[model samples]
Target: MVAFPDPNHAVRIAANELRIAWRTLRGKSTAQLASVGIVVVFGAAFTAAAAYGAYLGGRGLAENPGELSQLVSLVPAGLATITLFMAAYLTVVQLGDIDVRDGYLTTVPARDVVGGLLLSGYVRAAGLFTAPLLVASAAFAVGAGSPLAFPLAALAVLALTATAFLVGFPIGVGIAYLASRSAIVARFKTLIGAAAFLAYFGLIVSGTFDEAIDPILGVAQASPVSWYADLAVLAVVPSASAAKAGVVLAGSVVLGAGGVLASVRLSERRWYTESVEASERETDSVSSGRLDRLVGRRPAWVARKSWLRARRAPIKLVFVAYPAFLLVTPVQASVEAGHVTSSLPPSIALYGAWMTGAAFTLNPLGDEGAVLPVTAISGISGRDFVGGLVVASAVFGVPLTVAVAGGLAVLSPLPPVALACTVVAAAVLPVLAAALAAGVGTTYPKYDATSISRSREVVVPSMWAFGVYTLAFLLTAGIATAVQVPAAAGALANLLGVADAAVHVGALAVGVLLAGILATVSVRIAVRAFDDYTA
Candidate 1:
């Protein structure tokens, strides 16, 4: 029997695998490139802010050793809790699918294969590690008053992050193994996702209303993450806490190693699954035909077919629901919080309306996937096809926009005139969304298996739609502010209430007209692109 490669060889193999993955991603289309640029820009901005905050935090810790000591004590427990949650989520997502995709691992030497995979997982999680390490380094520099402290702090942070991933990965793989064999586990995945969302929402709400919950602070302090958070603070504090930090860090390493061993054992099982297959079957049986009836027997039917496609795709449904949820829940929460005053601005409500509209527009074309060719071959004019999509956008977009605007009016300080203007803007947003989606689809319509797998089709539409809505909100907010500021200063002396209302109404009308024109032009452009490609 031949001896397997050494540890160093395994690491080399894993590094090469990661390089391949990176190269594959780099070869994506122009749309994908733009999407990546947006993500990078956004991430860089957020990371810079976090690094600055960490520096300040470090300074504060140095000044207040006692507080830092308490915080640092909680780091280990916090790291463990985070690891547990992420591991559980990722494992569930992988269940039923990994065996088929990763079965090649069975043919490789067990230790080498396992080592490579574990290393790959860590590399994939580099983003998670980088942000915290930067913060820890900054914090240590400020707290310790020594440059050396920064590197030490970063090392401590990285170790803690790695420990969490180590613990999480094995548990996740085991769970995936068990989940692959059981229908109950599949249902549980959905439940877990929902629970996670609720838990996050609860945390945000509780933090915001911490003053009201002060009586239960003691009970809340009993949580494991709270303990870990304390450890994190202590890591930055000078003196005795450093020993405690070292102990916690050591514990993390042990736990991580154990988890990796367990995951290796579990990886021996063979399991294969694909969410797309199940999703497609379910969609075809229930939703595909439902829209055919609504749109009639005509092969040229665009609006009905597009709506059906959106409804059938589970991912698309979730994407649409996300914006709608954002629009509705916040307004309801603000009302409950008693934040609404009689003089509330329409800009706030209009912002929500525009967002809801844009969500509908962007996903339609990308969702078409392999069907794009059929539309071309079937003699369906791109103009008429896009017109139908506009109609469907109105169908879905107008109602949601109205509901959001009306909810905001009921909850906030907006007057009837302002509320009406908001509703008008909301109605116009769908048209804007359609125009943006059509433009993007025309420019970059080709998609492959990966696009379907990652749901990248939604990215361009979502991003561009968001950009349009944001610009609209800013413009409207500026106008509203300019008008309201002077009115308030004059104590309603030059309010000219009717004239202000008239101006808003006119603005909304103009926006809608412009959006409609844009939609028409976008469709024309997309049609030309489609023709060029097909020709």
Candidate 2:
């Protein structure tokens, strides 16, 4: 009979994996490292403050055990639900993206690789809480006058977190399993995934997540997971059920072992399964046909190529969603109020133009990927190349922006003059935005692909490019919008301590002057950069 893979071997592999991850973080850019450091520092500080608050609260509630018990009992189920959701989401996004997976599985056991990945995910997710949780546990022991409570509570927390990962990882694997076998899923997965994210984001932004989560919490409380609360409070509370605590301990061990086996089995099935490939051929006829006659050959070819790539893999343009998040509050407020706000039209116009440029022209060189060498050598002039990107973005973005802005303006309370101004701004801003983005993109080109999912990588604009483009676009868009919209012009006048009429006239002149200079300089720079770009 074959012996099962050695548990110690799995433990060793997990330790090494964690070690490598830690080391790899050191190679990140200074800005990236600084950002990570800031996040970690804030997270640790927040948790420490929360632990102190919990200690103080525990001391007060110690005198009245019934009220404290009722509140504390709900903690287990809430925490478990949150942990399970987070772990499962991370696993789903990162399951099969393991580096050199085939080599690892061939050298070691498949179960061991699964074990290592599970441990890695758990540490990445829950490691920050270990110290703070221990401190809180000790504080509870002191408040309740039971020294044994600290160890028991800590142990309970550890077991619950472990079991949550054990169960959650398999659930993620099960999702990957279904996604792998279903062609329909393979075809529309991005749209479905985007819808789910937007729906969840809407709930949060609308402050209705609590309403949605209460039912889930109710189910968790009625399930066996509620045993964790009994185990946690067994030593601290005089009325805590010892029998339930015993059951939780035994159940945790069983679940943990079973979860490992399930993860191994599910991972094997998921990793080995031949994923369903969409058999549909891309129809290039539409993109190539009319566009060629409308524009000359070189520009048309470039525009068609850019449009085709975007249609095939829209995930690369996902960075454009960042602007949408900023607009959600205004849009949500308008939805609730049953009418468009004065602010919504301008906001939509500005961000719509921003999204238009970012969707395509934001990474001219790097976006070409393997074809960069061929594209660089192809007899395409810089003017034709940059003009093509401008044309592609403008073709789609301009009409959409004008339609959205004009449609909203009709529904809004803006004066006819302001409505006309808004439409003009919508039409003009996108073309300039695209030019600015192309220049910024070439200056800070990033060639590496960022992982969007387990099986897909997208070459989005670099952070430096994104930051620079945002600054330029906002400056340009703000000036242009202020000159066009009377309300905005009035606001600028107030901020600058100037007359409204003077601000409006000055803004118009400055806006036009800046737009002309920016458009001219950016287009020239982009053309030069594209012409000089070498693979």
Top candidate on TM-score is 2
Cα lDDT of model 1 by residue, 133-220, tens digit: 5665675576557576676666666666677676777677767666565656554555665576666555554344354344344343
Per-model TM-score versus the true fold: 0.67, 0.89
Q: List the residue pairs that clash in candidate 2.
A: none
Taken over the whole model, the C-alpha lDDT of each candidate is 0.54, 0.77
The C-alpha RMSD of each candidate to the native structure, in angstroms, is 6.7, 3.1
Q: Clashes in each model (backbone N, CA, C under 3 Å)? A: 23, 0
lDDT of 1: 0.54
lDDT of 2 by residue, 1-535 (tens): 2223467776777788778667757765666688889988988887778677667656665666552354576777887887788777778877423677888888887887887787777887666665567677777777767777778888888888888878888888888788889999888887887899789778866668899999999888778777776776776566677788898889889988888788888888877878888666676667577877877789988887887788679778777886687877877777678788666777777887888888778888888888888887899999989889988898999999999987997898766666666777788888888888888888888888865654577788888989998898888676766554566777887999987667655664465567657767878888898888765
